[model samples]
Each structure stands twice: as structure tokens, then as C-alpha cells.
Target: MQREDNFTFLTEEPIPKVIGTMAVPTIISMLISNLYNIVDTYFVGQIDTQATAAVGIVFSLMFFIQAFSFFFGNGSGNYISRQLGARNRESAEQMASTALGYTLIFSIVLVVLGLLFLDEISVILGSTPTILPYTRQYLGFSLLGTPFLMCTLCMNNQMRFQGYARYSMYGIIVGALLNCMLDPLFIFGLDMGIRGAAIATVIGQIVGFAVMFRMSLHKDIIHYTPRNFSHRWLFVKEIIAGGTPSISRQGLASIATIALNVSASQFGDAAIAAMSIVNRIVMFIFSVIIGLGQGYQPMCGFSYGARHYERVKAGFWFCVKVGTAFLLFWSVVLFAFSDRAIGLFRNDVDVISIGIPALRYQLLSFPFWSFMIMANMMMQTCRKTLQANILAASRQGLFFIPLILVLPHCFGLLGVEICQACSDFVSLLVTIPIVFSAFREMHV
Candidate 1:
């Protein structure tokens, strides 16, 4: 009875309500997090166009940081969630501790190296002549906080595995609110400009880290302590094996951003800012679906672990319906307000003109992109690693890279704007067979 009670994915209730209960808090958390990013961009934009470009360039670096964090965080969380579902607390503790410890150590190393190579890193991220100074000021302080940043992600994921999404949401909410408040105060009240915006971000993240760590320290089914961690090669190997797909996904995203920045430089600084704004806006709108997909992941993982194939099928279909509806609604919102939306980030007439059309094109892909994302999430949760990796690689990986290269040559800037949406449409078509096949053999 106790084991059954602990197993959320084993619930025999209708899948929609069960998935909704789990997904709503997660969606709220992601939406708030996305709002913080938008706020970061908005406040920074007030400084200057150079400052805005700096935000975009530095964001690519942050994605690289998140890639490492997600690798360990998701890998560990996936295993731990299943263990907890099966009522095995000890193994969960070990995995949780190992992930936390590695994140801290890795974050420190990344921060030290990032600080040391600050200038070169900034240049490689495609900082323009005018944008370089502001980029340094923002990226430099942010590096010092990298350890906290990485640990925060691990803690958040660990908590989510424990089915404590509300606590995770609280930490992120407080952090976002703090950041939003400080952005205006630091930038305008203190007259500190770009550096102030960076400071605000660091301070806000520190608050989030503090809150998440506190929530994580409770006497739960899974706990994180250095003593419980293992130095065994197999444990590390397993974690890496499970996490490699995520590393490829997020790492490739970071690389793709760098490539995009380098490519856009030929067009000019406005091009970088314009595309950056478009990406941020797309991310903001997509957060709800991504959150719902994340909510579905643990359900899929635990159900697969227990061989509860019917529940897995139910949850998978539930997620697809929810994701489709949410994305479709937001796509309309974005399309209707794209011009005003892009203007919030910049006042440049040229930037707005290019950005509005690009933002619309990017958003047009979301309704279908939701299907691709949910499909990939389902594959990962079920440990269908090869399928997961392929799906993960499709959007910005194999498809986008080729499309990005070829389309620009063929159609110029409009090609760049429309390529991702076109690629997403094609990716969804490719995903149909795989998704349905998984559903067809839903019984374990």
C-alpha cells in the first residue's frame, strides 16, 4: 500500500486529471522562469542597443552552462525518481548526492576558467566592438555565480523528482520577483546601467539557490549529502550515459547560438539583437508546453520502470493533447501581437521590422513543435536513448544546421527567419512513425 501510494505514475485514474495535477505547477514554474529571461532582456535593452546585443551574446554562454547542469540534473533525477517510485530510498540518496556534488565541483571549475578567459570567451560569443565592454561586465559577474547557478538547477530537478514541484516553484518565483524588482532599481534608481542589470541577475539567482537548497535539505525519501556519494566508475558511467542525450541537445543549442551569432555578424549588430529577441520571445511562449512535457517525463519514467504500460500510454496521449492545445493558443497570441511584442525589446525601426516577421515565423512552428518536444520527452523518459537523441538533435541539430546553411544561401535573411519553423514541420512529420510505433507496442 505504501509503495503504491508513493507511485504517482501508477495511479489508475483518468490520465488527463492525473497529468494535469502534476503539470500545472511545473508550467507555472517554467513560465515564471521564462518571464525572468524576458525581464533580463528588457531591462538590459534600456541601456543601449549594444547592451541589448551583449545580453544576447552572453545568453549563448549561459545555455552552455545549462547544458552541463541539465546533463547531471536530468540523468540523476530520472534514476532517482524511479528508485523512489519503487520505494528504494538509499539508491536515490546516492544518485542525488553524486549529482549535487558533481554539479558544485564542475560549476566551480567552469566559473574559474570562464573568469580567466573572460575576454576570449566574450569575443568567441560574437560580441561586437561596442557590445564587448557591456558583455564583459555582465558575463564576468555571472561567471562568479556559475556554481550557484548549476547547483540550483540540480536541486530544482531533485526536488521535482521527489514530487515537490510546489517548493521548486516557490524558489524560482521568489528569485524571478527579486530579479525583476532589482532590474529597474539597479538600472534606473542607482544609475548603474548594464553592470547593474548583471548584478541584479546574480543576486536574484543567489536568492533562488539559497531557497532551493533549503527546501532540498529536508528529511525526504532522497537526500543529498557528500558522505552518500560514490566514486565508483559504474555510477558515473550510468549517469553520463543517461545524460549524454541532454548534453548533446543543450550543448548543440549553445553551439548553434554561437554559429548563429557569427553568421549574423555579417549582416550587422542589429541582426544579432533582432534574432536574439526573437529567440527569447519564442522561448517565453514555449515555456508552458516545455513545462508540461517536463511534468510528463517523470510519469513516463516511473511507469516504464514499473512496466505500467497502459498508464504510460494514457499519460503520453494526455501530454500530447495538452501540449497541442497550449501551443496553439499561444501561437495565435504571438502572431496577433508580434509587432508590439518585438518593439518591447528594442526601439530600432530596422530591428523591429526584421524581428516582428522573424518572431512570427518562429512561432508558427510552435503548434507542431509541441508534438516533436513531447515525443522526444516521452522517448527520454522511457529510456529509448537513440530515439531520444535523434529527436533531440533534429530541431537545432541536423535539420536546423543544414537548413540554416542552405536556406540563407538560397533565400537570404528571410531564409534564416523561416528555416527553423520549416525544419520543425519536417521533424514532426518524421516523428509520426516513431511516436505511433511506441504507442502501438505500449504494453511492456
Candidate 2:
């Protein structure tokens, strides 16, 4: 579609049609992006159980990188969407450029600080004596690609919010496919071990960033350049308000993972490895619902901005119903074969036993995500920062953090296993009324 028609479709097209067209590619893109890690884990799993634990341990730091990426990406993407919806193209481009520019600078700074204190950071991330060496090796290469990873995230969000999800998918898929191919080559073909996996990841990220950056140059998309960058107080406030939920979501996730690793460490490497595998598996599933929610989000922003509140309401409910049904079905499948699923990454008997039961507990609360994730996105897209931030933080930190901290200490490994499931159930109760009232207030 042409640039003008594409932007127009966000508000003018039938809501379901818009969502389906936009969401599928976005979903694919998300799954592919995640595949990079999954592929790494799969290959790393072959080495030994401890290597798998190392991968899992280092994931917390990676989440820290992702947190900042989402912060800038969503910060700028949300503002750009609203501006475009309001027919203010100049402001949209300016916000896009500013978010990317700021993200790049911050990421570079993080890389320097992170590399300087790599050993300390690894220990703090819950790496034990055995897993420490592999963790540092993997994290070192991953850090090299931090700037590009952040850039990829920022542009990916910007494209999706601009109603150009296909372009976003192309950029992401190109790099993900590259990573998949490079994984074996680097890890085994070149006999580099876990360090090879990290190198493949960095190379994939750089390629993805290049593709995404090139795509943004298209006239249909928002062009991000220094010339359009604005660091004004007004823009800063908007970015913070708009992106707070994303920051909360990704940031708290990092914290939750750190706590989970710390709590799991008390048991053994098996527990840490099991939880890591389970977490990745859960994220892969959750990313689908999130992608669908991403599909719904542009409609949410455009409809709310253009004052077509009924469309906003319609889009919200459509996502809730569809997301709920899928979660229900997938939960059953995951529950039925939890053993096989965890074994896919690590074949250790202990990891399998711990993961199978724990994964089922996590699956029990999967349906709640249909509600939690959609509501968070709707509120975020509509610029309800306070509610969105709380909802975002609730799942990843507020709820999960406390439970993981306390539950494991009391219940032992069982506490570590069920902590996330318990948190999800509580979050559902905490989340329902906030979102319902937000929807109740929407008017045409």
C-alpha cells in the first residue's frame, strides 16, 4: 500500500481487518526475534547442563538491555502514533529521531560500564562458580551488539506503530534467519562453544539493525535522523509518559528474572536451568499474545486520538476474546507435554522433572494473560501511563519479585516453581477493575 493509504487505514479501515493485517507480521517478527535466543539455548543445551544454566543466568542482563530498548522504542513509538493519528507528521518524525538518538547514546554508555565491570555484573546476576566463566564469555559478545540491539528495538516499534508491520517483519526476519544459520556454524562448526552463540547473536542483531534502519528511510515510514531529533522538555515528558509502561514491563522483567535466578540458585544448577528453560518457553508463548496486542495497539492509539472511541472499545474486546481462546488452547498443549517441551532444550533428568511440573503451574495462569496483556496495551496506547505502568510492573516485578523472594525461601524449590503462577493469578485480580473502568469511560 502507498504511504498515504497506509496511514489512513489505521483509523478508517474495519477494526478486525486492520488488526489481522497488522498483527500477523508483527507476531512473526516477534517470534523470529525470540528464536535467536531459543536457537542459542537449543545449541548451548547440547554442551552440558551447566552451559544451559550459564545461558539462563546471563539472560537477566540481556533483559536489562531489552528494558532500555523498550523504554526508548515505546517512548517514541507511542508519541509518533498519536501525532500521526492527529495529522501532525512533523512532531511524529521528530519524536522518532529523538528516541533513537537518545537510545544509541545510552546504550553505548551501558556497554562501556557493563564491559568494565563484567565479572562483578555476572556474579550479581546469580552466576555460580561453575557457570561464571561461560556467562562472562557469552555476555561479553552480547554486550558488543547492545547499541544495534537497542536501535533495532526502537525502529521495530516505530514501524509497527506507524502501520507498517510488514516492513518491520522483513527487517526482523532477515536477521533472525541469519542467526539461525549462524548458530550451528559458530557454536559447533567453528567449535567456539557458548561464545560462538553470543557472536552469532551479535552478528544477527547488526544485520537486523541495518535492514530496519534502511526500511525506515522509506517514505511510508517515519524517517529517524539527527536533523529531526528533538530533546526538548516537552518531548522528554511525553516520551517518559508514553514509554513508562514499556520500561516498567521490560525493566521489571529483568528484575524478576534476577530474583528468580537468585531464588533458584539455592536449589542447584538443575533448578536454575529448569526455570530458565521454562521462562524462555513462556516468553515464546506470551510473545504471540503480545504480538496480537501489538496488532490491536495502533488501532487503540489512532481510534483514541481521532476520537472514535467505539473503535477503540471494539478493538479492545476483539483482542481479549481472541487472545483468551488461544491461551486456553495453548495452555492445554503446553500442560500436556511440558516434559517434552523442556527436554527440547535440555535433556537432563533433573531439569526435566523440575521444569515439567513448574511449567504446568505457569500454564494454569496463562489464560489470565489474555486479560492482563491486552488491558496493559490498551491503556498504554491510549496514554494511560499510570495504569499501564502499574500493570506492566505488576506482572514482572511488583507481584513476581516479592513472591519469588519469599515463596522459595519457605517452600524450597516448589516455591521457586510456583512463584510466577501465583503472581499471575494475583495480577489478574489487581488488573481487571483498572482496565474495565478505563474501557467504561470510552465514548464515541
TM-score against truth, every candidate: 0.95, 0.98
Model 1 misplacement above 4 A: 1-4, 8-10
Q: Taking the tens digit of each residue's C-alpha lDDT, what string does model 1 give over 1-444?
A: 444564743445567765676677788888887766688899888777788888889999898888888788887877776777666778888888888898889998998899899999999999888789999998998787777778887777777756666666777787878989999999899998888888888888899889887877665435567798898776687577667667777787787787777767767888888998998988877778778887777677677676888888778777878778878888898899988888999988878887987888887778786688888878776767777788877777778777777887788778877877887887887788888887886766
Number of the predicted model whose TM-score against the real structure is largest: 2
RMSD of candidates 1 onward, in order: 1.8, 1.1
Clashing pairs in 2: none
lDDT of 2 by residue, 282-354 (tens): 9898999989998888777877878888888888889889989999999999988898999999999999999
Backbone collisions counted per model? 0, 0
Question: For candidate 1, which ten residues in a row score worst on lDDT?
Answer: 2-11
Model 1 deviation from native, Cα RMSD in Å: 1.8
lDDT, candidate 2, residue 243? 85
- The CA lDDT of each predicted structure is 0.79, 0.88
